[model samples]
Target: MTEDTLNSASIGAGALLSVLREGPARTRTELVELTGLARTTVSQRLDALLRHRWVVAADASTSSGGRPAATFAFNRAARLVLAADLGATHHRVAITDLGTTVLAERTADVPIDRGPESTLAWLAQTFTELLAESGYDLADVCGAGIGLPGPVEYLTGRPVNPPLMPGWDRFPVPEWLGERLGVPVLVDNDVNIMALGEHWGGHWGGHWAGYPEADQLIFVKIGTGIGCGIISDGRLHRGAQGAAGDIGHIRVAAADDEVVCHCGNTGCLEAFAGGAALAARITASGVLAKDSRDVVRLLGVGDPEVVHLVRQAGREIGDVLASIVNFFNPGAIVIGGDIAEAGEHLLAGVREVIYKRSLPLATRHLRIQASKLGDRAGVVGAAVMVIEHVLAPQAVDTTVTV
Candidate 1:
């Protein structure tokens, strides 16, 4: 029978699963009350969920009189999610449970420009190895999430004219990878997933926890290139064409016509402040640094010129963020990527500009700090993306039946 034919008392298995996913196991009576389903309907749906291993019997509920009622909880371990964070020069793959907890992970220096065929082939093989290593197989993985270091159309999961990723433009990432892994896949820009990782993972510079104001947050990644992931009202806001937080192209006061950006723009923020810019400047000064990682190493060795360059980049980035703070007024601005390794040197410059240029009210409770998740943010966020999608109520409704 069609779902529309069911009576109001015949609640779907997904609705019951959603309530249990909120934590704290509930008994049959509680599930009936919470979902407004008849006791028999709740019991039937709960039985189906139990048969599917989506829900499991937990400790019985305490009672003042008679025997305790059996309770059921969301079975987070019932399935797994494969997550991949592919960068310009590196890639990290992880296997996580339905709860987004990492079960196995692997990392390597795999370049994106190597083309999608080779890169994705390596990813597919690596996922197989990771699943085996974690004592699981393809059947256990519910879905996969990938974060590419370029512009990805959220609806199509295809890279559209990604400058760094030449061969990946408009490639069918989800369908291609999903075929290899035998599960559904989701893809998004790297910065967007990093933002999800930072915000959902709740790493606020240090061990700070229980941040109630996290509904509005921004994650800024200052690596070889600069970009931001916006969290508006507790959701990742991928704007029209999935380019909402492309702050790197924004023009800044410090930039001049002489500062040409790779995107064919003059005096853009990234031209003067991205890690590539600092590396270029340092190399031009006869430092022989190859990339952003080399620039960080120079900072570690107390290279005054490199230190000055990084701090200046931070200031340039902050100058752009100041306008964002005033306009968006996010609860926090999290700094991450390879450059964040420079520690206080980078943060000091960013804080200096944001606090000085932003409005008093905007900067009053603003938190500008380093990322606590560091390099792992991308992979963790990728897993979070898949977990949320596969376990969502609608998807669950299709997977489980009463």
Candidate 2:
């Protein structure tokens, strides 16, 4: 069935989820209004939730008239979803309760580029080790969400022509990992996971908190490569070809006109701003150690040359972001990656151009901010891609009018 045509139980579950998410159903009236479900259905689902310990009967209501009915809220400690972000150099695994409160997290420097077979084995082993260490057994876990640094067809749970990570093209990641881990798996692009982490974890600069809702967020990654995640209207916009935000492949001007990219294209965005380019610029500068993170470290020391390169990269990125802001008009832009570690040096360049080039009407309320999640953003974004998979409603296949 379509997302809009969920069965009665799913609807009831949806209603219960709404209440659980909001954390209060003190009265049946509130439950009815919040879920749009029939009162009886809400009651039944809530009963099931209560039985499952997902909800609990809390304090009593005021005794103004007669005996007050007790209020209920979600039991956050009842269930947990593990979020795993798989990266080329390292992996981050976190255990989060239903409320998104992380209980225990583990990090490993296991190389993810060692092919999917070996990497999945390491990942499964890490999960097992983490569970054992945290006293959180497999039975207590609700599900596992994983994020990868590649384009993923969520419906098929496979990478599609992932440019950087070889031997992972159209790889059956979720299926393979699920069979070994014995948990329902959800997977998506790494950038998508970071966007969710920023939204859920209070990382959107804390200035725009609760203003525009978590709907229309743009998280841009500028690291070993560039990628992006677009969360519009509170949903990930994968678009046709699953390349909606694959701006890394977009052609851009490079210092060397002859610079070739892995995608067999000249002067693509990644060739300009990816981790390699950042290092190449620094290495060619003859004044730095030729590392992006070191450039970030040196930028912190006010090195003019490194700062200039990072800002230049930011401006180039902003040149591209300008086209996107003109088209999408996202509420906020989160700069994430090693270059983003330079903070305002990079963000100022982006904001300068985005505001200068984009139409005034389109950028009316646009706010650009450095990613509060930083390097962790990708890994976290990766995990979120997976969590959003089955947690979300199926495609409605019907037009929705704002």
Candidate 3:
């Protein structure tokens, strides 16, 4: 073994704990091969990890004509995680173990506003009550993951000044939750988590999770407003301002040229295709006297105008998707939103326009469809935030030696 290759941190308890939290590891031989550590160094680290019960011995395996060596795996079940989704109109909290089993879950209707103080307090109280009722102690939790709408500075675990979500600018969501939850906290844009949850355990292959190729998968969200979560090369691409996937702000001329967005802009895609927009449009259409939900039922009954509005919304969204396709060249696109209940009529419009507008090469292999995860996508994404942070946490995990 090389003298300079050994690191003192390898012998420390914290480093050992970090490795175990990440996942299972092989014998010293395998760890050395994988981590580029010397065999003796790997042995020392594993020894510490084992003594602390952070890692446990698995079944022994035969090597090339040598004595059987026992494997080591993370004690995942020993730890639990807390996750939450602070939505626009409602909020939800869940506690789960490493196996992703839900031990406690609760929902609240705080309807987050410009400032987050009241909402944050409500979250803390709700979480406390739910955990107490479920018999899970806070100290036993390994971490907390929170998802919020709008752009977020993931490095700082804070939300940016998103126009729609006022009063939450620069709010340290993770730190606030961490103080209350008493564990490391991770915060991310809601759409990002939704993409994670939906894709990680998507229904594409039924019970078992399935994945499209990792090159490019776009998750388009149409809620009160619109947004998107982008995955490329198997990683989330948070932009310079941490708002890479804010697609709702994209300009779409379909709106009356003077139609101004809440962001004070004209012709935003959200102004036309968002759920709120759909509701307003349907209300104005007069043919559908009910509400947006009724529009879905009406469209199903072959109501001509309701069908046309749904198709038109899709086209507006597709126009924006066309630009996104040309720019990112995603392999597949998943549409998610409350109005998505409109079903195939909704997708048909998006596909028709995207195919017509996007460059042939860009749209040629692009598979456009609705997110199989549907309403569960956001919640699942919240859970995945905890998993990803625990696995390859950005601020704490990566290191380079001088």
Best by TM-score: 1
Question: After superposition, which runs of candidate 3 have C-alpha atoms over 4 Å from their true positions?
Answer: 1-40, 51-54, 60-69, 99-102, 202-212, 287-304, 393-402
What is the model-wide C-alpha lDDT for candidate 1?
A: 0.86
lDDT of 3 by residue, 128-247 (tens): 787789877787777777788778898998887777688898987777767777788888888888777656654322422343453478888777778999888756778886788898
- What lDDT tens digits, residue by residue, belong to model 1 across residues 257-344? 9888887889988788788888899999989887789989999999999889889888898899999999999889999888889899
Q: Name the best candidate (by lDDT).
A: 1
lDDT: worst 10-residue window of model 3: 393-402
For each candidate in turn, the TM-score is 0.94, 0.87, 0.82
Residue range with the least summed lDDT across 10 consecutive positions in model 2:
393-402
Error of 2 at 36 (Å): 7.7
lDDT of 2 by residue, 1-402 (tens): 232433444555534544455444466656666556788877776776677675688777865578886678767677667788776555788877665556777877766667899888877887888778888888877678887877888777798887767899988988998898777887777777777777655532465576674478888977677888888886778888666788988888444659787777787888887767778878887865554567788888888888888888888899899999898888888888666788888888888889999999878878788877665565455444544443333311111111
> How do these models rank on TM-score, best leading?
1, 2, 3
Scored against the true structure, residue 250 in model 2 reaches a CA lDDT of 87
